[model samples]
Target: MSLSFTSPNKTIFIYDSTKTSEVALLQHVKDQTSKLTEVPINITSVTPQLLNSILTRMEPGTSSLLINKTSPWYRCFCEDFSEMNDFILKKTFVKFPSLIQTPIVIHQDEVYVNPSMKHIFDIYEEIYV
Candidate 1:
């Protein structure tokens, strides 16, 4: 049997699929965090190629983007709202729209996140420390 070592560090690209503040805050957080210490999070463009690369690199320990609260991404940005929703739903990277509205936790092939902050902390503590 191969002795497996887990890589807790991961590249979390806060991809901005649309042109909005969501991109900025995520980018800002990443930038500020960069100055302090190594952050597992990274902000990047959410275009087709970038998103694909992000998923490709995902592994054991990973953190998804915690989009800024006011980000217009929760709803369709373009005039074609219905079509946009359909497109987002169809994509493998964004299959679950629920994750967009609410924070989601995925680990070991599982997805979970509670609405409360403390509960979220518990989950993070279990994963990181």
Candidate 2:
């Protein structure tokens, strides 16, 4: 028997809850993808403020994580992003190098981005699927 996650039926769209514009874009992407592929998706616009709450909702080892840093204005996100990454790393015991403004895969669960969303989704699809 193989171990696995009991994934939720809805596809969650996690994002930096503080960024309203990004959230809107994420919703747009979800809408476009759903219409194109007929996938049942649910948008989960989350932020670091709800970090713990968000983590608690995920099924163990069932995350399709991505960290994107495509904007020049990222000093803001890094603060909360770093804190959130640290929290997850401690919980999962995965390690990543320090961020000098680059996106990375933290704890093998989350992605730390420094600017790569276009190809990142393709990467996410490759890994998760």
Model 1 C-alpha lDDT per residue in residues 10-88, reported as the tens digit of each score: 2132323353543443454345333211111223222434333333344423323322334345444333333443235
How does residue 86 of candidate 1 score in lDDT?
26
Best of the candidates, TM-score: 1
Give the best candidate by lDDT.
Answer: 2
User: Which clashing pairs does model 2 show?
Assistant: 67-111, 67-113, 69-115, 103-112, 103-113, 103-114, 104-112
lDDT of 1: 0.34
Poorest lDDT segment (10 consecutive residues) of candidate 1: 36-45
lDDT per residue (tens digit) for residues 1-129 in model 2: 100131333233433434565455456555544422111111322233333433444455433233334444344444655455435633331222121222222222433332345654654554333
lDDT of each: 0.34, 0.35
Residue pair clashes in candidate 1: 105-112
Instruction: Let me know the TM-score candidate 1 reaches against the reference structure.
Output: 0.30
Candidate 2 TM-score to native: 0.29
Clashing pairs counted in every model: 1, 7
As a whole number from 0 to 100, the lDDT of residue 125 in candidate 1 is 46
